[model samples]
Target chain A: MALKFKTPMLDELEKGPWPSFVTDVKRMAARKPACEDWLGLMEMSYEHKEGHWKHGGIVGVFGYGGGVIGRYCDRPDLFPNVAHFHTMRVNQPASKFYNTDVLRKLCDMWDRRGSGLTNMHGSTGDIILLGTTTDQLEPVFYELTHDFGMDLGGSGSNLRTPEGCVGMARCEWSCIDTQALIYDLTMEYQDALHRPMFPYKFKFKASGCACDCVAAIARADCSIIGTWRDNIRIDQEAVRAYANGELVPQAGAHGSEKYKLDIKAEVVDLCPTRCMEWDGKNLKIWDEDCTRCMHCIRVMPRALRPGLDTGATILVGAKAPILEGAQLSSVVIPFMKMEPPYEEFKGFVEKMWDLWMEEGKNRERLGELIQRMGLREFLKACELTPDPRMVNTPRFNPYIFYDPAEVPGGWERDLKDFRSRHQA
Target chain B: MSEEAKARIIEWVKQQKKTKHYFNDLCKAVPEIKMMQAKKIINELVNEGRLKYWSSGSTTMYMLPGQDDVAKEEKGMN
Candidate 1:
C-alpha cells in the first residue's frame, strides 16, 4: 500500500534537497485511513494554493471557545473518512518539560479515542491531538483534565498558549523569571483562553534577554524580553586578562572553547551608540546613550554582565501579513520591573484587548489594528505615553509633529516630558 | 441493520411521548439495540421531523417538539 497511494503535489517536495513532511504523512497513509484523507486534503490544498481550513467553527470542549480547529475536506464526499476529523489542542507543561510517564499516558489515551495521530506540540506551544469526531470532544477533554491532570489551552480569537523560554531554570543570563510570568499570565487569563470574545488571536512569547531565542519580537503580538537600564557590570580585571590573551588554551583542554581576545578594532569602534571609550588602560561606557542592542555583550560575555536595574521591555506590532508585510515588534515600553501579580502588565494587556475588540475588523490582529489606525491613536486610546526607549532610531516617534516656531522650547519640552515620564 | 430493531426503537421513543433523551442515553436504556442501527433510525426520524435534535455542548439530544413544553408547568422557569 506504500506505493498504492498517489500524490503529485507532495512529490514536488521530494525533488528538492531539503527533507519534507510529506514523506512522514505518506508512511502513516499506508495503514491509517485518516492519513490517506489527510494526504488527499493536502494535495487538494496545494493545488488550490491557499489553505481550505477556514479556522472558526463551533467545536471544542464545553465552555471553551478556542483551541479545536474543525477541518473538513473541501470536497467532503470524495474524502468521507475525514469529514469530522477535528483537531484538539492541549495546554503544554511549562518550559515544555514533561515526564516520560505522562507522555505515555497521553499517547495511550489518544490511541484509544482519537485517530491515533498527534503533533507532539503545535507551533503555538500546545499539544495538538489531531482527528476526532464531535462525540470524542468532551470525553477527550475529560481524559486530559480529569485523568491526566491537565487543562485545555487557548483557542479561537482569544489569548493563545503563552510560550516561555527555559529561563532561570537553565540559563544564567536570563533577565527575568520567564516561566513564572508565563504561568501566572496563563492562570490569570484562563477565561480569555476559553472564551472566544476577541476580534482575533493574540499571542504572548517571552525571551530571557535581547537574544530573543524564541523570536518573540517577530512572532508574538505582545513581546516581552528581559533587559537592564543601568550600566553593564564589567570585570575590568577579566577584560585585561582576555586582552593580554591569557585565557587562550589548546582545543581539548578541559572541554572549554579556546578564548582569544584581540582588542584592536572590535568593541569600541563598532559600538552602535559610540558610548564606549577605551583609553590605553581603561574601559568605560556611558549607559545613558545605550539602546541595549546586545552586540557588545555577545562580544565580551566573560567581562560584562547584565546590570541590576532589571525589567522587561514590551514591544507591539509583531505579526504576519494580512494587509501588509510581516513585521518585527516595535519597542513600546522601555523598562518594566519583573514582579509577581503583574498588575500593571496585565492591565496594559487588557487595555490593548479592549481597543482591538472595538476597532478591529474580522480576523484582524492587534498589529493590523495598529497599522490601520496609526500608532498614536492606539497609544492615545490605551492611555500610555510615548517614551524615547520606544524609538528604534532617531526621529522615530510618530507623534512628534514639529512646528518650526514652537519647536525649540515648547514642543521639545512637551515631547521630552512625555518620554521621561513613561521611561521613569 | 434489523428493520424490526429500527421500528421497535422508534416505537419505544414515541412511547416516551413527553421525555427528551440524548442519543447515547436513549440507546443505553434499550438492552437489545445496536448503536449503528439506532443512529441511522434516529437520523431518519429527525429528518422527517417525527424526532427533533438540539445540542447541549457536545451531546445531541432528541425529542418531539409537541412534548417539548413539559416545562410549561414551571411558570417560573428562566
Candidate 2:
C-alpha cells in the first residue's frame, strides 16, 4: 500500500524556499512506504494535539554500542535512511592517507546494506550512516573495525569528534602538523567520545596555523591553533621589487603613490623588534621577535615569509548559542610540542573535559562554564601551574563614595540653613 | 465573516486600548485580518474622526480623543 502524506502549512515555509525536512522524508518514503506515518505527524506539528508520537525517540545503529541519541522525527518513513540508522563517530586515522579505493568500498557497502544517503560528517564529528536496520548493526560494526580498521566517535554527553585543518600536505602557511594532533587525541580519548556522562557537549578542533580556516574560533569548545615563537623571514629583494613598482601589492591602495609611500614609511619603518631593517641597498628582517602578525608579510607578500620551529597553541571555550553568544576561543595552553601519538595534547584534552564535566551546569557548554567560573578555577582544578602568558587580568576601578553628613565642623549647619531657604 | 474572527478582532481592539498600543500593534494582534482590511478600517475611523492616529517611524498608532477634556470645554462655553 502507498502511504499517504500531506504538505506542511504556509507559515512553516516562511523561513526558506524549499522545506528541508520534507525532502529527507520523501527520500525515506521511496524506501519504506509504511514510514509515511512520520510525514503525517510533521504536517500536523502545529495543530497542538496528542498522538502516538510525541517529541523524542531513541535510535540505535549497528556496530556502535554507546552514544545513541534520543531523536524525534515528525515524519519517520520520509527519513527511512535515518529511520534505524544512527551516527557512528569513527576516530580519523593518525595520518589522513585515504586510499580512494578503500573509501569507495566503504561507500559501496553502506549503499547496499544501508541508505544510499549519508552525512560525511555528523554533528558529533562521526561518520553518519543514514539508514540501517537493527539486524545489520552488529555485522556492519564488526566489518568496519575488523576489516576496515575504523573506530566510532562521541555520541551522547561525551567529547565529540576532534577535527583539524589540512596540514603541510597542500598549504605552505601551515607551521605544525594538525592531522597528527587530531589522530592522537582521537586514539587517546576514545573512551571519552563513546561515553555519555557529561553535563553537555564537548567539541575540539585543530588548525594548521592561526589562520583558523576550520572556524575553530567559533565552532569548537576547545581549539588548538598552530603558531611560532620565532620571527618572520623577510627578503629585501622582494620588498624593493614591490617598492620600485616591479611588483604590485596584493590589495588596498598598492598601485597608488600615496599607498607605496605609506607601505615604505609606516609598514617597513614600524617593524617591531627591527624585524624589517633597510640598509641603503636592501631590507632585512631580524627573524627573532616577529610575533607572526603577518603585518609585514601582508604588506610586502613577495618579500616576507613565516619562520620554522613552530608548534601548536591550545585555546579553550569556543561554542555558539549554548552558553551566552558566539565567542572566539581563548588561548589556554600557550604552546605545546606537536608530534604523532601526542601524549601532552591528549593529557590536556582529558584534564579540560574532567574539569568541565565536574563543574559545568545543565545545558552550559565548556566555554560558558569557563566564562562563569573564571579560567583561574579551571587551571587550578586541572593542576596546571598558571603561566605568566596565560594570566588574563580584567581591569576594573573601585569607587568610594563620601557621605556629606560626615564633613567636619559647621558644614552641617550651613547645609541645614540652605535646605530651609530652599524649602518651597 | 467567522464569529471567532470577529471576537478576535474585538479582543485585539480592547487590548490595544488598554495597552495604549500603536495601530500596527493592533493589526499584529489580529493576524487573521488582512493588511488591506486592517488599513481600511483604521482609515475609516480616522476619516470619521472617531479615532486619532499618531505616526511613529513607518508605523501608526490609534487612540480615542480625551472625552473628559471635550466635556469640560463644552461646560465652560455654556
Candidate 3:
C-alpha cells in the first residue's frame, strides 16, 4: 500500500517531550507500509471543520481489561484496525514476580480479540490493552474481574491503586514490609477503588522508610512510611574496624567517615540514653535509648543496626487542588501498626475519605480542603485526635506581627528594599 | 493594474477603513484566503496609495490613507 501521511493539528505541547502518540504512529508507518492508511485518516481529521474522531463510539480490548484507554475511529471503512487503546499500570510486587502463564493468557486474549500492539504498562499505572469495540468493554471487564481475578483502578474521583516500594523481602534499607501493606490496603478498600464518591481523585502510597523509593511524599494523599521506636545498636569494635579500613563501608567512603565520627562523637555526645559509651578501648550501646533514625545504622552498617520493632508513620493531605497545581502529602498519623488485613490503617483511610468527600468543594484535593478549612476542623470531623508529629509547619508562615515602627526608616523603605531585592 | 486587482484593493481598503482589524483578523474573516495572500493584498493597497498600515508586534492593522478626519468626526458624534 502507498504511504498515506496524516497532518496533525499543530497545537501547544500538552505534555512534556518523550515522543507522543503522533511520533509512535509515524514509527509504525515506517515498519509496516499498510499502517500508512491509519496515518492518512489522522491527517484528514485535522483538515475537517469539526473534530477528528466522532464522539460516542465503542473501542477497547476483550471483555474486562482496564489500565488501557480506547478510542474508536469515526470512519472505520477508510482505515480498518485503527482503534485507540492505552495500558494499565499495576504496582509491581516487591519480589517482581509475575505468573508467566497469566501474562501469556492476557497477551493471547489481546491477539485474538483486539490489536497485537501491547504496552507493558499504561500511564495511570495499569497493564494496558489497546483497541476494542464498545461491545467488548463489559465482557472484557467481566473476564478481567472474574476470570483473571483482577480489578479496575481509578475511573473517576475515587481511590487510585495503592503503590509500594520493595520492602524487607529484597531491600536492606526497608525497615518494614511495604508489599504486605499495599496488598492489604487494596484488598480492604476494594469498594472505594471501584466506586466514585469524592469531589476529586485520591491516591495512596506506602514506603518502607523515609528512603521513599515509591515517591509517596509527592504522589499519595495518605502516605505510610516505615519507622522504629527503638535506638541504634552500636558496636565499638566494628566501628574501629570500619575506621581502620578493616571493614569496607556499605555506602562507601562517606559512610566509612560517618561511622568513624559516630564512634568518636555523636555516639558519645548525642546518644540521649547513654547507650553508647567509650570504655578507653571500645564503644558500647545500652540498647534502650537507641531510637532507630537509621543515622547510625546507615553510617556503620556492620557495626550498628536497627532493632526488630517496626511500624508505619501515616501522613495526610499531600496533594494540591486542581486549580493550584501540586502539593506534598503531610504526616497525619505519625505511627501505626501495619499487620496483615490492616484494620487500623483501613479505618484511618475510611475516616479521611469520608471527611474529604463530605467537606471538600468541587475540584479541591484533600490537601487543599485541609488548607482552606484548617487541619483542626478536618481532624475534628474525622474524629481523629491531634497528633503533633503529623502537623506540618507551613514553610511560608505569614503570621508575623508587623510593628510599623520597628523599621530603621519606615514601612515604605522596607517595602522598597524588598521590591528591589526581588525585582528580576 | 488589472480590473480584478483594483477591485481586490478597493475591497481591502473598505475592510481596513472599518476600524479594529489586523492582517490575521482579515485572514480569519475570509477563511478561504491564506495569511500570505491577505498580506500581499494589504501591501498592494498601501503601494497604490489606497490604504495606510501600522503594526503592534506581529499584528499589522490597516486604515484608509487619510481617515484621521473621519475618525475625529466619529469621535465628535459619539
Candidate 4:
C-alpha cells in the first residue's frame, strides 16, 4: 500500500542526546514519497561512505535558468524509486507572512504535481519543495506562478532570495518599513533572481535595527539595516526608574542588596563610545559618537528610543565562503533614504552587479573580489564618497590614508580648517 | 641560494612532467639543494607564475603551470 525501504545505517544516527533528523524523516515518510527518497538517499550515503546524490543538471522551467536544483542518485540501480529528487524554490512572501489556507493550498499543489515533502521556509527564505522529477517541474511551475500567484526564487547564482524581518508591521522598535522595501526589491529584481548569470550567488537581508534580528550584516552580500541618523530620544524619568533599581529576594531566599542599582555598571560602562553619562540625576548621550549599535536601546528600551529620522545603512561584500574566508558586510552607504520604489538602492545594486560581472572570476564571491582588489576601488567605481561612518574597523595604519592630499601635517591643517568653517 | 642552485632547482622542477613534487621530494632529488634553498627557489618560481603550488589535503605540492589535467583530480574547490 505504501513504499517501504530498510535504513539500518540511518537508524544508527538516532542515538545520543540530540534528537536525530532520521527520526524526523521517518515520520514524514509515512505518506510522502519524497520523504522516502530523501531517507533512501541519506541511508545510501551512510552505506556507501559518501553522498550518493549529484547536484546541478540542466533541469528548469521554461524562460527561467534557475529556481530549481536537480539532484540524481548515483546508485539508481539499487534504489530506482528514489532516483530523481529535484528541488523547486517558490518565492516567499515578505516577512514570511502566510495564511493557513494559503499554506494548505501550497501543500496540495506540491502533492498533486510533485513531492509531498516541503521545507516551509528554507535558509534562503524560499518555500523549498523537495524531490520531484523533470516531467513535473513545468506543471508545478505553471500552477504555482500562473494559477496560485507565486513566483520562483533564485537557485544558481545571479541572486539568491532577498529576506526581511517583520518590521513596523509587527515590531515596535522597527526604525523603518522593512517589509515594503523588501517586497519592492524582490519584485524589481525578479529577473536577476531567476537568471543564473552571476560569477557567484548574491543575497540581500534587511534588519529593522542594529539588533539585527535577521542577522543581515553577517549573512547577506548586501545588508540593509534600518537606523536613525538623529540623536536617540531618551526619557530621563524612565532612565531614573530603571537606574533606581528594585529590591528582590536573594537566590538563597532573603531579600538582598546584591541586585542593587547596577545600571551604571551594566549600561553606562558598556557603551563603546562612552557617549552615555549618569551624573546622579540624568542620563545623556553624546549623539555625535553614537554608532547606532542598539546597545543602549536594548539595555534601556523603555528609556531610550530610536530617533524618528530613520533610514537604512547599506553594507556590502558579505558571504559564507567559497575561495576566501567568511566576511561580514562592510558599511558602504551609511545612511540612505528608505522610501517606496527604492530607486537609489536599486541603482546602487545594479552598479555592484555590473562591476562584479566585469571583473569577478568564476565562482568568486563579491567579498573575495573586493579582498583581491580594494574597497577604495569599489567605492570609487560606484561613485561613493567615503565617510567616517563607512569605516567598520578602525583604520590603524598611518600609512593608509583615505585622502592622499591630507597626509603628513595636512591633517592638522584640515582639522583647523574644519573648525574655522563650522565650529568657529 | 646561489644562481647555479636556483637554475638547477628550476630545471629539476620543470622535468617533473605533469606530476607534483613536494619540497622534501625536490630536496631528495636535488640532494645538493638544502631544504631552505629549495623552499626559496619554489617560492620565487611560484610568485613568477612559472610554477603552480596547490595544497592537497595537508600536503602542498608544486608543479609547472598548464599541467592542470594532472592537478585537477586532486584539486577541490579551493
Candidate 5:
C-alpha cells in the first residue's frame, strides 16, 4: 500500500495544469490496494508504450449481453490485484440529477466492491464504474439493482443509453419536456438497452431546443430537438429596453461590458435567415422567412419567446466519424408532438429499428446504412412521407437514374429496342 | 406461447450447430413472435443456462453454451 512501485513518468502527469487520472488513481490507491497495483500496471504500460489490458471471456450479469466490460491483465503475474479488471456501466438518471444521499451511497457501494474509479459520465451518458474483478460483478450488480433501484446501461451492439437536456426543469426556451421524454423511452426500451439487439450501437438523444446543449444532432442515431411552428413572440417594451442599452442582451450570457448590445448590429444582423429588421424606434421580424435557429430568441430572451404551437423535430442517421464521415442528423419527421406514453414516437423508433435490423450489414451504423441504401429507400421502407424540410436543397446535377418500373416500358425490352434503332 | 418461441429459437441455433447467431437471427427463428417477445425469450434462455452470450469486443452474438471458442479457452477463469 505504501508506494508499491516507483512511477516517475506517472508522477510527471500530476504536475500539469489539468487534473490528471494518475492523481485520481493514487487517491483511490490509498483506500484500495488493488488500485495501487493498477497504477503500477499503468506506469509499466506508459514505459512500454503499449497497454497491458486485454478484454476476453464472459463477464456480465446473468441474462444481460452488456453493461459489464470484461478486461484482463496480460501480465497478471506482476500485478495480481488487477488481474481481472472489469468495467460496469450504470444507467444514469434523466439529465443526471441525484441527491447527495444517493450519490454518497453509490460511492460507498462502489468503494466496497471495486477500485473506486469512475467516469462521472461516459460518452454514452452512463456512469462508468471502472476497475472491478469478474467475481465481484454479480454481487455488485445485485447490490446496485436491489439496494439502489438502478440498472446497468447498454454496451456492445445494442441501444446505448438515451440522454436529454434539462428541459422544463430550469430553461424557459425548452419547447418539450426533454427529461420526461427520455425517461419514457428508457423505460419502454429496457430490453434493447440491456441486450444486444442491433447490428451495431444505436443512440437516442433529446435536446430541449435547437441550441442542442447535449450535441444530439451530431452524435445520436435518432436526434429529437424541440421546435415551434408559429411566429416568435416579441415584447415591444423589452425590445426597446434592449435597444436603449437599459437591459443587457443575451440575458448576460456573454459578458455585458465586452461586447456592446447593438440591437441592429448584433441581434438583427446576426439572424441566420435575415428575417429581422430594426429601426431606431421599432423592430420588425418577417416571421414567414424565419427558420427558427434560436439565435434571435437567445440574444433577446426577455424580448422574444417561442410560439404557442410547440413540438419536437425528429431527425435520423447522425453519428460521429467511423466507417463513414461525421454527419449531422437530417430532418426525418419535421415536427411531431412529443408527449407521455409516447406511443407514436415509440412506434416510429421500432419501425426504424426493424428496417435497420433486417437490412443493415454487420458493424454498419444507421447513418452508413442510410448512405448505402439512400434516403429515398429509407423513407420507402419506413413508410414515411417525403417532407420539404428533409433536404437543404434539391439535387442540382441531373444525372438521374430511373428504375425499370418507373420508365415508359420495362428495362428488358429497352436494351434490345435501343440496339435495333442505333446499330446492328 | 413464449415456450414455443423459446423452443423454436433453441432449435434454430442447434440446427446451425457451430454458427454464432446474431440477435436478429434468433428473432428470425420464431417468425410468428414479435421481435421484443423473441428478445425476452432469448434472455430467459440465457438466464436458464440453455444459451450464452459471445462477444467480439464490439459485437455481441449468442450460441449454445459450449460452442464458444473464447469461453472454452478461458474455461478455467470462468
Candidate 6:
C-alpha cells in the first residue's frame, strides 16, 4: 500500500520480527482518514519523545455514563481529522465468537461513521472501535445497539465486561459452562456495566478448568476456575493404548517429540501429589491424594476424565499493579455449583460490590482494597466463612489480633488490676 | 423507589455542603437501597442534567451543576 502520510518513526516499527500494529494501522489508513491522522500523530510522538494526546472529557451516548473514552489530539490544528478521536467499546459476545455477517455489518458501520480500526478484543474483552469524532458517537451507538443488537461494554468506575474461555462449546476438558456463566453475569449486571457506580473498575473472567486458558486467576477481580470433588475417571484400555504408543501423549499437544513415550516418567512422576502409578500392565490412582490440578488428565486425555460431579472454585481480588503490586486471585469459595441464574453467585457479587462501593477509596482496585483492609475483614464483610482451603498456606506467625469483644471480661479490668499489682 | 432514593441522595449531598462527592457517598446516603438501584438513580440524575460528573483522570465523582466555584471555595476553606 502507498503511504498517505510520512510516518518515518512508524515505518521503522514495520521492520520488527513480530507482527506490528503500525503495519496494521497503515492498512487501515488507506481507507480511514482518521487512521492516517493517527499515524501522523504517533510518528510525531515518537519523534518528539512525547505523546500528543489528552484524555478525559464528557462524551458518551444518551443515558450511558461509560464505554466511550474521550480522547483528543493536543495539536488539533496539525491533525484536525483526528482531533476528537474517541474510543468506543462494544460489548463482545461470550467467548468472542462472531459470525461473518455481523462482523461485516459492524465494519460497514465503522467505515461510514468512524475509523475502521479495531482492537478486536480488548483486555476486558470489549470490541474496542478506535478513533471517531464526538458527532458520530450517538449514530455509531445507535447503529451498534439498534441495528446490531449489541450494547457497549464498561469503562471508568464500572463493572467491566465479563469474559470466558470457549467452554463446552469446543473443548473436551471443560468441566463447567464458562460461556453460560459469563453471559448470565453480563446480562444480570447490565445496569452496572453502563453506569459508573463502583469506586473502581471490576472485572470477571471464567475458565472452563484449572488449566486457566483465559488467565482468569491472574487478571480478574472475580476468577471462576472449574474443578471437581470426585475422582478422575479412568479408562484402562485407553491408558494401555497411551502406554503402548498407540495414542500420543498429551494428544500430541507438545508437538514432534523425538523420544518415545514413558508413562511412568512423564505422567506418574509428574503428578503433583504422586497419586498415579503405572506398573506396565495396570494404572493405579489414589484419588484422595489428587489435587485436581488437571496435569495427569491433560497428559492422558483419552484415559482420564474429570469427575462426574463438577463445579468451579471462586477466587476474588486479583489485579494488575497500580496502588499495590500485582496480585493473583485467592480462593474465596473452594467450590460451588455453577448452574443457570446463579443466584448464590449473584448474591456474592452484590455483597462484594456493596462493601467496595461504601468503603473503598477512589481508584482503589478490589484487590488493593482487600489488602488495605485485611482479608479477614473482607471475608467478614462479604459474610464468607473462613476456610482452610482459602489460603495456600496458613499464617506462620502466631501474632493474631483478637477483638476486645471476643475476650471474656474484655480489656477493662485488666488495666486496673495490672496497675494495682505493679507500681503505678 | 428510584425517585425516593434520588431525593434522599440529593438531600444528603446538599447537607454535606460540598460540590463533589464519591459514588460511595451516594451509596452511603441511601444505605437501604442496593448499589445497582442507587446507580440507576444517579445515572438518571446525571442524564437529566441535575447532576454532573467531575473527573480527576483517575477518579470520577458526582457534583451538582455549576458547583465548580463552590468546590474551589470548600477546598480553600479546608
| Candidate that would win on DockQ | 5
Q: Across residues A1-424, which tens digit of lDDT does each residue of candidate 1 receive?
A: 6544468868888777787677776776776677788788778788879775433334455555556765544455666667667788889887788899999999888877777788977888899888876678889898888889888777655678899888879876789899999999899988667654455678899988888877899999999999998889888876776677655322223346555555546677778788888774567889888777776676677777788888899999798876678989978777899899888998888788777755676567788888889887788787888666666665554556444553465532576878877975
Q: Which of 1 and 3 is ahead in TM-score?
A: 1
Highest-scoring model, lDDT: 5
**Where is the poorest 10-residue window by lDDT in model 1 chain A?**
A246-255
Error of 6 at A310 (Å): 0.7
After superposing candidate 6 on the true structure, give the runs of residues whose Cα lies further than 4 Å from its correct spot: A1-4, A256-259, A394-424, B1-21, B25-38, B54-59, B63-78
lDDT string for model 6 (A252-337, tens) is 78984434458899889998779888999789999977778998888889899999899999999999888889999999998899
Window of ten residues with lowest summed lDDT in model 4 chain A: A246-255
lDDT (CA) per prediction: 0.72, 0.59, 0.57, 0.74, 0.85, 0.84
Predict model 5's lDDT versus the native: 0.85
> Model 4 reaches what TM-score against the true structure?
0.76
Predicted candidate 2 versus true structure: per-residue lDDT over A1-424, tens digit per residue: 3446555552355458765655665566676543355455545654655442322122234322244332234334444323343333455553345788868867887766665556655544456665455456566667777888886556544567788878777767777777767876777766556533455667788787766767786788888788777766667777777676666675444453423424547576666545666655576666554545556766666776666778877878887774498887877787787877677877876677667655666557888988899877787776666564554432233333334553465243476778888984
What ordering of candidates by lDDT runs from best to worst?
Answer: 5, 6, 4, 1, 2, 3
The prediction achieving the highest TM-score against the true structure is 5
Output the lDDT of residue A295, model 2. Answer: 63
Off by over 4 Å in 2: A1-58, A61-97, A123-125, A243-291, A295-302, A384-424, B1-78
Q: Give the Å shift of residue A101 in candidate 1.
A: 1.8
Work out the TM-score per prediction.
Answer: 0.73, 0.61, 0.60, 0.76, 0.89, 0.87
Q: Where does model 4 exceed 4 Å of error?
A: A1-3, A12-20, A246-261, A393-399, A402-424, B1-78
CA RMSD per model (angstroms): 14.0, 21.2, 19.3, 13.9, 3.7, 5.3
- Candidate 3 docks at the CAPRI level of incorrect
Q: Per-residue lDDT tens digits of candidate 3, residues A1-424?
A: 2356535452222247765775564555664433455566656766676544532211222221122333445565676545332233333433244699878877776655545445665433446565554455566566666877766555334566777877877777676788777777777766555433455567788888776777777877788888766655557688787666576565674543333343556446655445567655677676644434455566567787665576887777676445666888776666677887788877777677767655666557788888888777777777776654553443345354344564476564467778887974
Weakest lDDT window of 10 consecutive positions for candidate 6 chain A: A393-402
List model 4 lDDT by residue over A80-193, tens digit each. 555677888888999999888889999888877765778878888889988888779898988887877888887765477789998999887788788998888888877667
Docking quality tier of candidate 1?
A: incorrect
